[model samples]
Target: MNLFHFSEENGIEVFVPRVKENRKNMPPVVWAIDDVHAFTFYFPRDCPRIVYTRTNEMSDEDHEKFFGLTSSDIIVTVETDWYERIKRTTLYRYKMPSDTFQLFDACAGYYISPQTIIPQEVEPLTDLLNRLMLLNIEVRFTPNLHPLRNAILNSTINDFGMHRFANAKGN
Candidate 1:
């Protein structure tokens, strides 16, 4: 399986394990996302995003409520303010070997490695919005994500990821 690490900065020769501020209790580790879910990270590092997919577990009511009239199975929402930055940002996709990494969250396609890693290759990705569109991902711009975040939390949409929410507006 192909594993990747996305970053706004380039020239990353090695990845070292480090504890995240919010995940202090967990052991230090290098995080990577599998190819299947890599599209979710195609944005500025701190840009807040909420991604959800239509799953079998979703009820008819919830489906219509969240995805009414939309044919796309995956939806990615970001704050309107970040649109300009996203258009200008270029992300470096670092290909990492899978030998030292283990699945961290299957649903999120997240993997973790305790050992330091040197990327096999680094590819720069531009035209972020177009890239997401090419993947058939529906991108929504909102003034605030709290409402949708709250609604999803209270709904049956389990296949979702809310990232960097603290950076979201009105957080």
Candidate 2:
């Protein structure tokens, strides 16, 4: 399986294990997302987004509410304010070896490795929205994400990831 670490900065030859300020209690490690969910990182680092997919456990009513009329299996939503920034952003996808990585959060496609990693290659990703469409992901832009976030929190759709939500409008 392919593992990747996405960043806005290029020329990153090595990824050293580092403790994230928000996750200080956890051990230092390099983080990577699996290929299946790499699309979650296809935006600016601080861009707030909500990604989710329908699961068998999700109620039909909840599915209709979030995905009604859409054929996409995956949905990614971002605040409208970040649309221009997302369109202007160019992300680097660093392909990393998975041998030393261990699954940290299966649902979130997060993997961690304590050892420093030298990426196999760095690929530049552009045309963000088109890329998501190519991946069969439905992208939604809303004035505010709070309503969707609250709805998901109360719904039966458990397969969801709200990234950098603290930076979202009105938090």
Point out where model 1 deviates above 4 Å: none
Task: Return the number of clashes found in candidate 2.
Answer: 0
Expressed as tens digits, the lDDT of each residue in 60-143 for candidate 2 is 999899888898989999999999999999999999999999999999999999999999999999999999999999999999
True lDDT of residue 136, candidate 2:
92
Best model number under TM-score: 1
lDDT tens digits, residue span 20-117, model 1: 89899999999999999999999999999999999989989999999997999999999999999999999999999999999989999999999999
Spell out the clash pairs found in candidate 1: none
* Estimated TM-score for each candidate: 0.98, 0.97
Best by lDDT: 1
| Cα deviation of 147, candidate 1, in Å | 0.8
